[model samples]
Target chain A: MNLILAPVRGLGRATLAVVSAVGRGAMLSVDAGRSLRRVDQWGPHLVPQMISIGVASIPLALFIAAFTGIVLAIQASYTFVGTVPLYFVGALVGKTMILELGPALTGLALSGRVGASNASEIATMRVTEQIDALESLAYDPIAYLVVPRVIAGTLMFPVVIALAIAMGIVAGWLTSIALLDLATPQFVRGLRLFFDTYDVQFAMFKSATFGTTVTSVGAFFGYTCTGGARGVGRATTRTVVVSSMIILVLDAFWAATLL
Target chain B: MSIELKDVHKAFGEKRVLRGFTLSVERGETVSVIGGSGQGKSTLLKHVNGLLKPDAGEVWVDGQRIDQLEGEPLYETRRKVGYVFQFAALFDSMTIAENVAMGLRRIPGLSEADIADRVRTALARVDLEGVDEQYPSELSGGMRKRAGLARAIALEPAYLLYDEPTTGLDPVTLSMVDELILRMSDRLGVTSVVITHDMESAYRISDRIVMLHEGRARVAGTPDEIRDSADPVVRAFVEGRADLLEEAS
Candidate 1:
């Protein structure tokens, strides 16, 4: 018991120091007055970051969302057989697509793509003392570096998710018509029946939270990294793994409670 | 305004970096701290800017308790202190003019035109007036160091702390940096504290010298006093002992 307590006490002290350092960094960030300046500097860099996160993920988002929707429709059709009309298939798939799968999977994919990239980039900057240089120049690392990226994540992720859902629905609709021979009118009617305003609201809510969580966690870890190159890499990997896990877990919790 | 450290103590785990260290520098005094690496020269400078706190004792800046200052006041205190690192430490993302203009933009009521003028003047002071549009990576070692100096002095701080200002420069560039330090001190009336292993640059630029050893000020005196001191550590340092010289050739 004493031996365990000894290590616990040491860990507690280390945690306090880390907390203090972050608090100091946050305070200094407010004083730096260069958040706008950082955004300007980061503006050019974000093009590539955005391209990787938003543009590159497009094909994958479409592929996954569409297949999932079609598979769900086929499975529902198989189970219902003659009990429900074949037309109800689109509604079942569309509802699940927008309300559950679209936002959740898109968030998951982005957690791997955008969130990890943010962590590695910022962690590299932190390890290399570039963040320290900003602090020394009286630029707030949080306000200048972290805040803008956080805002960008909060704003940008939803747009990407929206794109994911739209593309997903289009692909699923085409698949049903081409492969299953479901009438277009039947498909549209089924989609309208299953997808409601409430589901859309809930879906958006989950995605926004997912986006904010991934970004905040990624930025926090990256900014507080210690050691050098190896440490930064470890932080980056940890961010991707941890954030992906948390997003899925949080999605489950939200779904259960909201439903 | 003066800066003073009284019985300061700092440690990282079991590795004690500062132990009962004490020193003082009066207004406009250009004191150079000369010591081997890991002797806590940079640590001592950090204490002045409130970047680090003493584990035991006090740091007084212009008669104000540095560790006690908090929030906006501490930031305001920091604004009056300028620091230059060994590598020039210019923000690579910013151009030369933007780097120099960094601190100046924070001052309220300064028009854009006035900020630009001040930036140019600061650059001129460092003899880096024309290359305002170039990035730090584009500049020569001497120019990068000077550009950092321009940024450091931009806010017209009352105190300047330079960490090995001549570390990686060639002999000609080293002297140029030395001359610039001397000229800035004389021209701006900024109290300067320089940390360096370069004994020649130390002698050329400092009015007084403090030699740190084992985390304490082993000796503090004028450059001549340092040269003439009978302290064995001082002698070894002045003679450029191979072990003490480290990487500073």
Candidate 2:
């Protein structure tokens, strides 16, 4: 009976902890929303963040997408065997890259790259008393630090994902021609066979949401972290893991609801 | 125009701090709060600036209950107080000049020219004249502290709060920081509340020294009074004697 109660209590505690975290995250987002009204204060930090969080993330995003496209095209061929039309490789690669892999993979990649950095940077400031300094100096930490990153991530994520998706398709096209017997025209035909503008819209929308989740999750954990360097390391790790999990969840949600 | 905290209580999880703490620094007065590592010295200072709200009491500044203030009103109240953190806490990325200008830039009508001028003047006041282009990382610990002071003064806050401003400094630099604090109060006519573990600096710069023990002001008086205090805790801290702490406890 004690063992049973212990496990039950553990489960309840974990549930409460998760719920508490969600509530905290929501409050942070609400605070960021309020900071929006003081645009003059937070606005100056936005462009630099876009450059840092978005523009700097491109090579990594495109690199992951390109490799994914190659593996995807090859996998489609291997899975379907010779029984299916070879052009289906193009369809598989195009659809999967545009609709699923592109944003999801890029978001995952950035969850590690952008998300971890964001958490560590802010967490370092937290431990160093810079956040307190910001507060005492009459600057809103949420507005001056967190909001710009969130806005940058949300606005530039789609742009980065869009580029990655295109890169993936091109890589897949090249892979089909060189590796598989499928010609350019055949691959193009397959790509065009089922291309829907709605697919692009869905990917963009999903990527935008992923952006917000990644940055906000990173910022939230950073703000809440304590201890010292060890705390910063924990926040960085949490940012990556939580952002990746949320990205996958959002991916599934978008696919189920939109498609 | 005084900064006051009345019966303030604060705690983190299981560790209760600042229970029933009370103190007030009149306008233009310089008070130094000294204590052991976790005796709520910093916590008490944070209350005065509205950085940490008290759980059971009130913090007042300029006739406003600052602990109850939020948003723009809180910001408005905070703008009048300048806090120099323990670690300097300068923005890591910005140059010293930009850091000094940060709070000034937030003001509505300050032109770029005026902001730049204030930055220059603030830096000069702190004796950090030629390191404007350098980052906080590039500066020595003492310089970074001065830069932090410069940043605080750039806003021309009526009240200045210093948290361990002379910590981790050599004797020369410590004396320099002590002098800087005195100069800020004299030059700007700003009331100051400084938290420090250093007894000498406190004795030199503070008109009054308050010893915080177990989350409350255990001893409050002039430096000479604090030195000659009959309280064992105060004697332990003022005389730097760990043996006297046994008697205190």
Candidate 3:
């Protein structure tokens, strides 16, 4: 009896897409280095794209973290009340926020804003043959296109995560102090004393990794998208979804290894 | 001193675009390939610069087999061949000066002033002086095409390829482009292979016209010879008869 190959075919296509996207992004990165020699041509444009993707990401990150911190504190308080003593609340919240939730959530938020935007922008450039123009001039499109994005993401993600962590901690602190009636100084001390210095290093490490993943995946998907505007839309959607999923998986793996 | 293709064959899965297609362009000769769309005209140009490789066969630039060159050698091979797209295909985000400076950046041992002088000269050659600071979006269609041409020739390539150089221009602009092609080819002594279905442009600019059919050279001759040929296919195409087009289709 012959089994239908539909599922296998679908898997193959998805795998092909992921591999192709990664390969294309890396190729562009190499090309970008070559194109960087013409930095005078690309410099002004690169400034704006980097600023738009990096600087504008700040407020949106804070907004997400504020709500997220509120929700997490409420959930943890509800789950751990009576089962554990009240003093453990700060420790639990601090560990989760600093270690996993802060960087991971920041990257997930970025996946929607910056990832989708990068993908659609690059895909449009591709469809319009702007990318081809770079090649014709012997300018590497990757170095000209993707490297700025990777650099922006690498430099920007940590800043956004740091902002998110600050905002979330404040929000969590406010909720615990006002709504849950936990002592302020005790909560602060619990968070301060929770872990060794290695945890901060580990958290920054996770943020950097997530930044690389977001930029690479987004660029790969964007540059390889075929057809036209509709294709760009599909690429943007897929980039965000794939980037978010990867963020979660990587976050889990890092937590397991680092902890 | 010329670009030559020896038995170039390229296939996409089961469909073949070019099958054993061979052609040559002598130094300082302007050759035009006139073919229906999807006849591998654009693909032929791409192969010369190593953008796309042939499935089987070889392409030689000067005396070098470009198909076998890779890395720095392949890029060096590309530095000597310039291709202009049907659309201007200017890098939209870059200023005109930056676009023109693209190829000049990689020139080894050239001083900054020398590179700047070259960029200025190349832009001036395309009649785009004083527009270096402008972006491509600020230019009109004719100007953009000229800008594209400036970028193409900025490297001072020994060979140039034009892919549908006159497809989207008005009669006036088209004539202007045709004039630019002739003037540039004459001035630089660059071997030119232009692919176009525009008969008038083909006749005006080409030293010889080649009619490509079914992925091979169907007929190649001087413009007068092509126009006055006794071959039925050539006669039908030159005359633009509906029945002939239908039959060819």
Candidate 4:
């Protein structure tokens, strides 16, 4: 009786925590949505945040996309030996990079970089009473802090994804030429044969959704943080974990619905 | 503006912080709330500006019930109140000028020139000069506190709330802060509420002192009256008698 009851209690606590987090996240989103109407306040912070969240992320995204593209080309070529046309490797690499790898990997990587940093920054503000100070001064902290970050993430995510996709394709083409012994024209021709412009649109949509999730989740955890340094650490870790999970879940949902 | 809290009760999780706590401060008055750790002194100060709503009872600022206010209404109330946090809580990323200008910029129809002039004037009022471009981290502890004071004074608020204004300050800085608090109250004619454990500083700066014990106001009177109180708890606190507190408990 004790054994069964113990596991049941644990499961119940976990479910309650997840549910509580979701409710809190929804409330924060509503508050942020209201704050979004005050563009006069948050507009100045947007460009600076974009540079921080989007421009600073380019090198990491490009580096990851390049390696991912090369690996995908090598693996696809190996698997397609004699079973299908060798040029089909280009089609596989292009589709996979644009539709899946580009947005998914970049989102996951940035969940660690951008999302964790945002959580830590806001958590520090919470612990230090800067949020209270903001409120005391008659400034809405969500408008001044969270909304700018969320807007930057949402707007710049697609730009990062586009850059990542382009880098991924270029890396794959280079790999196919040098390592896979495929001609450049053959690879380019294969890429054009079955490419759909809709795939790029689909990737952008998925990335924008991921961007919102990463930032809003980070801000929610950070704003609600209590205790002190230990709490900030927990919020940062939770931001990465939750943001990455949401990105993957959204990735699957987009693929299922759009494809 | 006058500030009042009537029968306020607040709790965090299972621990109660304030239970039936009440106090009042008239306009242009300086009241210092003194209590041991975790006695809800800071919580009481926060309620005045609608930073924390009571779990029960009422909060009134200038005859207006503020506990039910939200959004812009609450902001309007807050704009008239300046809260200085224990650690100053200045934005570390911003320079001193920017920190002081933050509240000034929020007011409607304030030109850039006006904001800059106010920032300079506020800094001068706090006796901090030639440090506009420095960050909060670069300032000494006393300078940081003065900078925080400048940030609050820049708004020219009607009421000022200080949460442990003298905490962690050296003796010189502590007295400097106490003097600043008193001077600001007189010069600006702003009602001031200060939360502190330093009984001496409280007695020095406040026109009246409220002693909180176990989440409720134990006594309220002039500093002399409180110092000469018959209540054992008040006596224990005023004289730093730990044994009396132990007996009361």
Using DockQ as the measure, which candidate wins? 4
How good is model 3 by TM-score?
A: 0.87
Worst 10 residues of 4 chain A by lDDT: A33-42
Native-vs-model 2 lDDT? 0.90
TM-score of chain A of each: 0.78, 0.95, 0.87, 0.97
Runs with alpha carbons beyond 4 Å of true place in candidate 1: A1-89, B140-142, B242-249
Ranking by DockQ: 4, 2, 3, 1
- The residue-by-residue lDDT of candidate 4 on B1-249, one tens digit each, is 389899999999898999999898998999999888878888888888887889998999977788999888888888888888888999999999999999888899999999999999989977788999999999998789888989998998999999898888889878888888888788878899999889999999999999988889899999999988998899898899999988988
Query: Candidate 3, residues A1-259: lDDT per residue as tens digits?
Result: 1356887888899999668766776676676566666565556556676687778988998998888778777777788788976656677677777787789888898988998888988888888777776666565566667777776787778777877887887888888888887889967876776866677678778888888778777787888878888899999999999999999999989889887
Q: Give me candidate 2's TM-score against the actual structure.
A: 0.97
TM per candidate comes to 0.83, 0.97, 0.87, 0.98
For candidate 3, give the DockQ: 0.42
Off by over 4 Å in 4: A1-4
- The Cα RMSD across the true interface for model 2 is 0.8
Point out where model 2 deviates above 4 Å.
Answer: A1-12
B1-249, model 3: which lDDT tens digit per residue? 488888899998798999988888889999999877798998888887777789999998877888887656776777888888777777777798887777777667888888889889888877789999999999888788888888888888888899888887778778877987898689979889999988989999999998877788889999999988887677777787667767755
Better of 3 and 4 by DockQ: 4
Q: Is the docking of candidate 2 incorrect, acceptable, medium or high quality?
A: high
What CAPRI-style quality would you assign to candidate 1?
acceptable
Which residue pairs in model 2 clash with each other?
A: none
List clashing residue pairs in candidate 4.
none
| Per-residue alpha-carbon lDDT of candidate 1 for residues B30-146, written as tens digits (9 for 90 to 100) | 999998788989889988988778899899997789878764566677778888867776777789998888877666688999989989888887777789999988998888988
